[model samples]
Target: MRSGTDVAYDDVNELIATATRLMQKDAAPDTLTPDDVRKIGEELDIPARYVDQALEALARRREEQAREAQVQERHARLRRVRLRRSAWVGAAVLGLLAVSGLVVRNGLTSTLSDVARQRAQVRNVVERRESLRARQDTLTPGLSRDAELSGADNRVAIEQRRYDERAADYNASAASFPTGWVVRLTGLPHVLPLSSEVSTW
Candidate 1:
């Protein structure tokens, strides 16, 4: 017959949930160190081999995530370079056209000003989202995982979605026809240009 240590968990979430329930029943400490973790595993009838396997899986996941981040950063840089080149070339053409009165500078200038305003709005939304995310992280260990944490998470998601929408609106205006070239020329960020345009705070 299988022992209690033979507990089968399909995923990390299941393992955490099982462990948490057991710990709560045992009246374990709120905080736990590495040794505490191992001890708890023993008390919970969790196999040492499973713990090692979980650690290995976690390490591999982190490494994969790091590599993914590097790739995103590289792609973002490449996009910026390509955009810079195009924007500068367009700016030169615009300057010549403006000088010869072929293109009305006032109309384009007004559009660029509007794009800058949209960019400012995106930044404000990003600030609020980040602040909420920080609080969520702080409360992860002991906070009620139900309504309060979910509410905070929902708020963050909403802000992030709002940021994405506003950024898309800005990028659409900035990337269309002559406005994109002008916006970049005026030193405005693309703000989620490509779907994979990764950015860090």
Candidate 2:
């Protein structure tokens, strides 16, 4: 009679050989039946009880493997969904940033344009005042006392004052929040106050 260890070893060998043959025949392990185990056991001269245990063990292993595969597949699907969601979120954030940059650029351009226009007006007023003074200097000394000339000088002074005030007001507005950022970025200098002296003949 064979020792218990020898019998167990022989049974394990028979099981391995039977499984190998089934694999060579393209039999799926998950599709193995108790009848197939019994047939293998009978052919190998293994006990019926042992054959039943081996069948149960094989079924349990197959079920565990199936469950594991399902869990892995579920994890892979969830990971793909999360990656897609993250990509969408990133794209939305980038779009928002691009829109915000365009809005800021437009605002800065508008502010700078207004500042340039105001400066040009102020320069024109100064040039006109200078021209008037030079014309008065060329007039006859007797004509210098004329009331019409005096009134014209006064009007020019008032207009100069008005232009200066407007320039000051624009500067103040540019120095305020939001618009001030544009001023700093463009390196705009402060607008000087116009001379208070009126041109007289």
Candidate 3:
């Protein structure tokens, strides 16, 4: 078995130079002579049998180098494919994030719109209460102690005033209740209209 030390021992550059000279000489138009091989073997200080082995080893090495270069080129192509696939994956992730962000923004906008509608409805109820109270005030007459003592109708008027005031408070609460949330959260009847019948004190 060739250890790392044995593998590194051969001077590849010198061997290649020697092989090139031998090939050029043999390939001349003239026929190879035994003297040529003898001279090369003596000059390189190698046996004739070892020289033949070296030539075969050189051919095998050249073939291995070609195969290694092909493998390296294939690895480079695979790396490029992987890089392109990664870029596409990154883009897909970014697109998904953008879509998710838009969805969240739309949800927030809808929530804000719902809140605004509820606020507007509550404000409308408050304004209506104010108007109703103003009207009720005109109907209620202020009574001094002398007027209170003077008539039974005045006592009836005072009792009627209390009823209207209580009814107005309920009407205000019913009108201002948030229709969407309240209907789902609690089951309740609508406020009935006020009565115009005179009260008997």
Alpha-carbon RMSD to native, per candidate:
37.8, 11.0, 18.1
Give a tens-digit lDDT track for model 1, residues 1-201.
245656456666887988899988789666656666677789999988887777779779999999999999999999999999999999998788566342433445554465455555545655765676677676656456456556655664565555566556666765676665655566656545422353532
lDDT of 3 at 138: 61
Q: How accurate is candidate 2 locally (lDDT)?
A: 0.67
lDDT of 3 by residue, 11-62 (tens): 8787678889999988885744555765789798878887677667877999
Name the regions of candidate 1 deviating beyond 4 angstroms: 1-33, 96-201
The candidate, 2 or 3, that scores higher on TM-score is 2
Best by TM-score: 2
C-alpha lDDT of residue 124 in model 2? 66
What local lDDT score does residue 167 receive in model 3, on the 0 to 100 scale?
A: 51
What C-alpha lDDT, on a 0 to 100 scale, does residue 96 get in candidate 3? 79
- What TM-score do all the candidates reach, one by one? 0.32, 0.53, 0.45
Worst 10 residues of 2 by lDDT: 192-201
lDDT string, candidate 2, 1-201, tens digits = 346645566588887898898887885565656788788888999999998887789879999999999999999999999999999999999897667555654655554465456556555655665676678677766655365466656665666566566656666655666556655665654343444432322
- For all candidates, what are the clash counts? 1, 0, 0
Error of 3 at 88 (Å): 0.3
CA lDDT of each prediction against the hidden true structure:
0.65, 0.67, 0.57
**Cα lDDT for residue 14, candidate 2:** 82
